[model samples]
Target: MNQVIHTLLNHRSIRKFTDRKLSQEQIHTIVKSAQQASTSSNVMAYSIIGVTDQNLKNELYKVSGHTHVKNNAHMLLFCGDLHRINRLANTEDNQQTIDNNLESTEQLIVATIDAALAAQNAAIAAESMGLGICYIGSLRNDIKRVNELLELPGHVIPLFGLVIGYPDHNPEIKPRLPIDSIYHENKYKPFAEQEQFIEAYDNEMRSYYGNRSSNTKLDTWTDQMIRKFSTPTRMDVTPFVKSKNLNKR
Candidate 1:
């Protein structure tokens, strides 16, 4: 197998971390690798903020349900930002502003995809260097608080946060969806075989969860499904996204 491919395939999310601090050289190299990911239109509509403050990390960790994040070496908050460009183009530069401002869904999509690609690149780079990473999607849980904390300007929004550090424990590589379930040959397909795959997956997850947990409680995937979708945890996103004074798509 290709070395890079093998490394990617063996990838797993790591939660535990050592107290070892990352060197400045390591941070620079990792971020440089991230900057190498492909970007649409070369707009590079994203920005990364490295957070080192313990109190801020703690607040964000609580919001994200990842307590260990505060203890990790540090965090990288990646944002989908069009504000910088908009301000530039709309100002003395005599540049053409993105039509409809940052409110255009296309601009937002590009920013989001760009940020995600960059983040994945960073993650791979870190993994190759024997470092651990876990993405904090919960940053969306309280976007307002996150915006206030990050001091993000209009037309800019955080896509997610990345917690990186040296590994303190080895976590198992979780199985993924079958290729058939996600890959369509020519065109898009609806949820026809979704139930079947989900059934098998639920069983598999239940078994996997049992092995990982002490036999104290039945950790079924169904329970997870119920718990996650049953609550409206992230509905504040739409309104929050609108707070950027973006054009409505």
Candidate 2:
């Protein structure tokens, strides 16, 4: 495989970081790489806020409930932004035209996808530079608080945070589902041996967790999934999204 594909396949979420800080030039290049990612219809409906302030990082750490946000060399909040587009539309056309297309589920989905793609590009670039990165989805635990802290405007939502830094610890690459289970042929095919596949994967994860150097837990992938989904998570997100005038259609 080429170096790019090799880097992509060797991805891991890094939670521990060293004391080293990324230079401004590195940060600029990484963001430039993110901007180079493909966007749906070239709308590029996303924005990134790079946070290096310790106080702000502390506040965001609490909001995220993840210490990595504060510990990392840099934290980037990727946002889905329809506000810019709305303003541009208003300037070009009229308020009525903007209003007609502002609160759409399709627009929300597109912006979110755009943000995700951009963040992934950033992550890949960081990894290629021999840096580590972690995605902080827990920032969505309290979306309203994040919105307020960041002083977000309407039609903009903080999708997730990306923490980048030098690695303090090396982590095992987590296994993924078998190729056959994920990649379908001409038509979508349901797993014929679902139980068998799951059992094998669960056993593999059980070993993985048990043998891990830190926070070793006696659990399997299925066990974790059951525990996680058994309870409602981030229920406030729906109301928060509506408050931003998104996903309303």
Candidate 3:
């Protein structure tokens, strides 16, 4: 494979990071790379908050309960933003129509997708620059607090945080599902046809869990997933999202 594919394959979720901070040049490059990601109809419905202030990072850390949020050299909160487009489009000529469109469920999905696409681009760019990165999805644990702390206006929401810095610890890359199990030829593959694949993957994951360098445990992928789904998480997210006047359709 080429260098880019090699980089992608070796990706790891880096939790511990060194004290070195990213230079302004590096940060600029990463953000620029994110902006280059494809957007829906060129709307580009996303914005990034680069938090360098120690105090602010600390607050975010409390909300996320993830040490990487505060300890990283830099943290970026990627937001789904329809507010910019809403404000720009809601002139005397089109206020009513624009307001209706922005509040639709379709628009919410569009903004979220755009933000995710951009964040992935940023992550790859950071990795390419020899930096480590971790995605902080726990930021959604207290979604309202995040919005309040960031002072995000309506039609805007913080989706997740990306922590980037030089690597302090190198962990083994987690294995993913087999291609044939997920990829379909023309029609969707039913569960009956994929049982063997799942069984094999569970065995592989059981071995991985038992032998990993840190926090080793005896567990299969299916069991872990079952435990995860059994407990409802971030239950307040739906109400919070509606409070922000998003996804209200």
Candidate 4:
């Protein structure tokens, strides 16, 4: 395979990073690469916040409770931001119409998807430059505090944070479900039909967890999923999103 595909396949979430920070030129390149990602109708309804201030980073670390937040050389918050375009696109003649459209659930989905696409591009760019990266989705654990810390206005919510820096240690790639289990030919494949594949994948994952270098455990993919979903997580997200005047419809 080509270099791009090779990079994509070898992707691993790097939590341990070195002290070396990314240069301004590298930051600019990564952000520019993110901007080139596809957006719905060219709305480009997203914003990237580079957390440079040490105090701000500290605040985020407190909020996220993830040691990697402060450990990384750089942190970036990718936001689903409709506020920028909403302000610019609104005129006295179209004020009500613009507000109505921006508040819809569809727009929220669009902005979230746009931000996610851009973030993936940024991740690939950083990886290509021989840097380590980790996504901090736990930022959403306290989205309101994060908003206050970031000084984010209404209609713009941080979807996730990305921490990037030089790798301190190389990690083994996590095993993924087999292609036959995930890819459907034409119609939707039911879970009942894929039970055998799931069982095989569970064995594969059990072996992976038992053999990994750090924090090794004897576990299956199904057990992990059960633990993850058994507890309701981030239940405050809906209320917070509504408070931002998004997804109200």
lDDT of 3 by residue, 155-238 (tens): 899999999999999899998887778999889999988888889899999998889899999999899899999999999988
Model 4 ranges with Cα > 4 A deviation: none
Worst 10 residues of 4 by lDDT: 88-97
Taking every candidate in turn, the Cα RMSD to the unseen true structure, in Å, is: 2.3, 1.5, 1.1, 1.1
TM-score of 4: 0.97
Candidate 1 stretches with Cα past 4 Å from truth are 90-99, 213-217, 220-223
State in Å the error of residue 88, model 3: 1.0
Taking the candidates one at a time, how many backbone clashes does each contain?
1, 0, 0, 0
All candidates' TM-scores? 0.91, 0.95, 0.97, 0.97
Candidate 2: worst-modelled 10 consecutive residues by lDDT: 90-99
Q: TM-score for model 2?
A: 0.95
Q: Can you write out model 2's per-residue Cα lDDT over 155-179, one digit (the tens) per residue?
A: 9999999999999999999987666
Clashing pairs in 3: none
Model 3 spans > 4 angstroms off: 90-93
